[model samples]
Target: MGDIEPGALVLRRAEPADRTALAGTDPIAAAGDPTRRASIRRWCEQGLALLAEDSRGPVGYGVLEYTFFEQGFLTLLTVVPGARRQGVATRLLTAVEAACTTPKLFTSTNVSNQPMQQLLLKSGWRPAGLVHGLDEGDPELFYLCPSENLSLSSTLRTFPDTVIGKESRI
Candidate 1:
């Protein structure tokens, strides 16, 4: 409803107990897509999901996995419509990047998703390439954020010595 202060939000690895709240924020999952729900569960189980929460509840979640040619790939990033443009995606992305285990983290969004492209660019992710036929008309644009580019100071500044569970707050 109101602007959410970035510092007021908590970013941590998603757990089994978080599946329902995480799915509720996802449009597809909320719409009763069983496949999407299953994917969310799998991501959480595999330790590849990050959840963003404020006092209100779960606002966003991200999934990063090494399924893309053995390198890190951000397969999903979902922020509730109400939470969209308030830095939740950025925080989720930064946390995903921090959790990346490979040298290069890659992600792609449909060309029609301009907001995502802008977010990736502003967050220091560079355009890697583009591929057609992924979404029929709208091409998929790939972006990359190399591990070397992730400075230690950026992570420290974002989290500010916060750790909420077995996982350190990102």
Candidate 2:
């Protein structure tokens, strides 16, 4: 496939026809979590799953779920392995945020998932809070859109210092 700009990606609700291609096949999910396929399927069935495609095909996806406090939660975002590092996740996130009805969108990633955290941070998602005990050692870090204009040096202050490791900080 030719190199397509990330901004050129088209976003749409996932279709039933895309299920086999996505779930039946070994589609990549954030943090390489295998359970995501099932969740993606469930979201698609609810018409909350979004697909991002380029000229090649579906390169990434995101789920705009409302299970969390009835807010638009970016429950899952995945970029196929071949499409990683190409801004696919960013595009997918943008689509999810746009679909949100609130001023801020919510999403979370595991503490160990540095790549996703960095993606969230770079895409203007800010540190909101963290959830513990979901998975030992690695807590789930939450983030939200409409972040303040923070510089690299002042970024640390925006996030709690206690979560340098004990908690999840972005």
Candidate 3:
């Protein structure tokens, strides 16, 4: 889940026009759960949403914010079950790290989500601390990556003049 070889993934800043398409296909938004949709919408308002699309369409997504944590925080990352292990998550993460302009980036995963923990470790994110009572028997596992270690090319190959939206070597 951590080592992703970027392929046809097209990274783009999410726009309002994407809401319908996203809500219709994105698992969280399509869950028919008003709460999740509202939460995602709220994050969108802050312009923290990034959508990962391929020839087929949206395969993964991530949201970044500073309100929850003083540092750059990846609030949410979702990859369709079918897209798992294909480096989509890693690419999404690399995009997050590249777009982040803060001194550090922080994120958390439920204790039960072992895959995410593995991904965090493999991606060079270190365990910062933990928060209890966040989920039953599953205290949140916090991870942080200092700016010095936040190298986007380490995870995804990119051109010297590359920017978001352009394809990068896998």
Model 3 misplaced stretches (Cα beyond 4 Å): 1-6, 24-26, 151-170
Error of 3 at 31 (Å): 2.0
Clashes of each: 0, 0, 0
After the best TM-score superposition of candidate 1, give how far the Cα of residue 126 lies from its true spot, in angstroms: 1.4
lDDT of 1 by residue, 49-93 (tens): 888888899889999888899988999998988888898898788
Q: Candidate 3's residue-wise lDDT over 1-170, tens digit each?
A: 23333456677666766766556556757978888787767666666788777767777788878865577899888887777988878877877787776677899999889999998899889999999998888899999975655654344433221235455432
Candidate 2 lDDT, 1-170, residue by residue in tens: 45666356666778766765555323454345667666666777777877767767777777777778887688878777777888777766765665665444688999999999999888877899999999999999999876332223133422222212231111
Report how far residue 124 has shifted in candidate 1, in Å.
1.9
Off by over 4 Å in 1: 151-170
Sorted by lDDT (best first), the order is: 1, 3, 2
Model 2 worst lDDT window (10 residues): 161-170
lDDT of 3: 0.73
lDDT score, candidate 1, position 72: 81
Task: Give the TM-scores of the predictions, in the order they appear.
Answer: 0.88, 0.73, 0.81
> Model 1: which residue pairs collide?
none
How many angstroms is residue 112 displaced in model 1 relative to the true structure, after the best TM-score fit? 0.3
> How high is the CA lDDT of each candidate model?
0.81, 0.68, 0.73
Pairs that collide in candidate 3 are none
